[model samples]
Target: MKYIVTALICFIILVLISSCRNDFGFTSSTGSLKFSQDTIYLDTVFSTIGSSTRTFKVYNRSNDDIVIPRVALAQGTNSKYRISVDGVPGQVFENVELLAKDSMFVFVETTVDIMDFTGDTEFLYEDTIEFDSGANLQKVALVTLIKDAVFLFPERDAEGIEETILLGTEEDGVRISGFFLDDNELIFTNEKPYVIYGFAGVPPNKTLAINPGARIHFHSQSGIIVARDGTLKVNGALSTTEELENEVIFEGDRLEPLYDDVAGQWAAIWLTAGSINHEINYATIKNASVGIIMDSFNNASNGATLKINNSKVFNSSNTALLGTTASIEATNSIFHNSGQSAVVARLGGDYNFNNCTISNYWNGSFRQDPTLLISNAIPNTEFTADLTAANFTNCIIYGDRNLELALLDDGTSTFNFKFENSLLRFNDSSNSFDGIPAYDFSNINLYNQCILNVDPLFEEVAAFKLRIDNTGGANGIGDPASVTATDISGTTRSTSTVSGEGPDAGSFESSDLSGS
Candidate 1:
């Protein structure tokens, strides 16, 4: 009886194994394989750098289990691109089994050496992934524009560590450090994009001049700094007809579409103490923690630290223009879309903004600060500096907040400011600033010829286009003498006006040549 029972158990186990084998039998169905995408187009990438991995799905949609007899690249073993099937890394795969109604992932990556190809500066790389003896073939078009860039990086030590220099001495006894640039590497041209890996500082007594049509790309936490006694001049001119015109661009290094409007990708363009004679013209600065930070420096000999004209500073995580006891003169410029204030003149030395537009419609996060903040003291710190003069003429300050302007005075030093013929969007509906001395509209000396709580009727706020629409009441409202002859787009500011013939109260003049 014991021998008979043992034989029955062995027979039962054999039957179960046979059933599992039959359930997973391979099918010769070849054309039933489905793919996620017919063709995958990888965007432009620089030379000698590995691109981000792109993924696609391979699905077995038939009722039976399928066995891919062969899966390989069309280039055989000489392909520059690399592929991974499922989780295994290889150029070719075989006997890849997939159950019915299941799928697997195939990841593709590549690093192209531009010397291997023959082209001006960009080359096209293509490859195919063949499956099951050519029964079904899928191709991924790998095209990249390999640009030759002037790479600026810090020197690495023997252990591959980057060297750094002191940024400044903070009030809390903390020291900030960053990478420094030599005097020989001061001039940047427009031949190729300048890619900086860290904070590229202009050393003392050195001057960094950027030519027109230059594109400066910065990595995360990277920026450009002008050290004490250093000068920075960006000679970007306005062009209306040329294809590659002279307009300098500063932004993050990510070239993907998802990262186009993302803010705070890099740090600020810091003009440190004692830095002098910095100018930016017809430039576009975007996607940074702070657009331009002018540190406190009492340079009576240099006049102002920076003079910016016909430029746009937008999409900053912090204030677009931050002046801490620093002098700045901006004309025909636009400062918009900041997470905090668009312009923060704290402990200011001297600031003059004419024919400019300061607006903030930040929707990235919940912003607690106003669009414009002016103060003569640092909050929570016992540090105070004199605000000698701050003047805004023929400008517009508007945003999507209840109260878009804030003025804080410690009542210790001189806080002198004047707003003339400007449109301001400040709401006192809740009486928030009701009894505040700084916000008293009755003071004609501080607020002169200003229009309050009026809509500018912008063309498009989401696209950062602040051109005044037809419904805007700002036309012919500005002082003709205070407004510039030509707006930022080189159009006459009074072209649309007929009766009064006065300029508009913003950086842009409404005309046919308004769209960028």
Candidate 2:
């Protein structure tokens, strides 16, 4: 009987021990807590912009529920990074419980000021997420490259209110205002990159000259506006020795490779009405909502509203060149990868292109518009304007879409255009263009001296190299008199043995073939 009583006492002690284990929390002393990743890498974040939230799962692999004594950043509250544990935001957390066979989430985010750190144009930040009493630690490798730029923003008053100004005329005024540069700030040199926060306007009768090798970066929805009677002259020239240097660059402020082709990061270079004598030479403008917006204000006495030569405008979210009842002449230029038309002349405008390549192969999104569009009316609006003239000579207009050219005439105004000695991509399998009188290719006067649906044989489409190959059908099809002497890259156009002495039909001349 005594032996049986001792056994019973041992059983009671065992039951008590099990109950105590269930009642008390287990400390994370065994280092058995596992994480989804040992290190969370936050890639290339812009200065002053919060990064996308990243998540890491903390799993309790052991048999018992473990309570983390402390979960905090190594730098405590002084760190730039921020973390949230189970939806609770804090730099330091204690008594975080993880049930057995369960997992909890930790979300991380950060916004670092570039000027606050020191290094190259890009700065790197590091911190650790420690668990318990610094016994178990998981590192979050934070690295960012801060790009220094000339910030151009509107002045704020004592109450932090931005100033305003009138954008348009009294008749059709756009009461929009932003930072306006004075005479001293009108020049943009190559010393440093310029970052515009809002619409940077050039005062009336003033000229904003951008020197060669100047890099202009724009923030979201930011751009440069040439006010009425103002001139924007981009004096970018090709270096005699350098292949791709000395050209002025206009793009979004993000320098990461991931944002290289991201469109709509900023607005356009707006050329308001009465703004004349504007020129862009050897400039690279890309990744905007609209590349160049030439408003409907024509100086019949002055030259075209703007003249672009040996330049490139591509990867725009909307139209690359939107000329609304405005005059524009572009030569030896390239326009491509637009969400809408590469070149859109709406409500009448005098537009001309010579030896220019306008291609739209935008696969980024669902593109409903063609590459080249000419309309005498605005859709869904009661407004209708005349299309004065649109002439393309020695040019190549092609894209992945079936119809790369759309000419919509409202039948009220004059709609006139001509394609001479050019390669145009238009598929009439469904009679979309042939049935419409505005796009009737059968009319020799409208579509005269042009090649239809023929490949231009671009060297590389993905690289944005629209140069025609030596054996391309476009090579030597252009008229020598109509084509430019040199291509956009200053290379001499190729001479074809079949078509006699003439250059290719695009902006770029193929270096694979020799010309005599």
Best by TM-score: 1
Lowest lDDT block of 10, candidate 2: 137-146
lDDT of each structure? 0.82, 0.83
Structural RMSD, model 1: 3.8
All candidates' TM-scores? 0.90, 0.82
Q: Highest lDDT, which number?
A: 2
Q: Which stretches of candidate 2 lie over 4 Å from their true place?
A: 1-41, 45-47, 54-69, 95-106, 118-122, 131-138, 169-172, 239-245, 254-258, 300-302, 377-388, 410-414, 432-445, 457-473, 500-502, 510-516
Estimate the overall C-alpha local distance difference test score of candidate 1: 0.82
Clash list (residue pairs), candidate 1:
none
Clashes per candidate (backbone, < 3 Å): 0, 4
Can you write out model 2's per-residue Cα lDDT over 1-516, one digit (the tens) per residue?
Answer: 999999999999998888877537665645667889878776665567666677898888778878887888989989999999999999999878888888989988888887787645556777888877654654445444445556788888999888665765678866554777988899999876788888899988899999999989888988999878899999999767544468999998876566888999999999988888999999999999999999987555566788999999989999899988888999999998898899998988888899999999998799999899888889888888767789999899999988898888888888888988888998878864446666667688887668889888887776677877767657677887678888988887655435634688889875453231
Clashing residue pairs found in predicted model 2: 122-145, 122-146, 348-386, 348-387
TM-score of 1: 0.90
lDDT of 1 by residue, 418-473 (tens): 88878898888988788887788778888887889878888888888888864475
Give per-residue lDDT, candidate 2, residue 399: 91
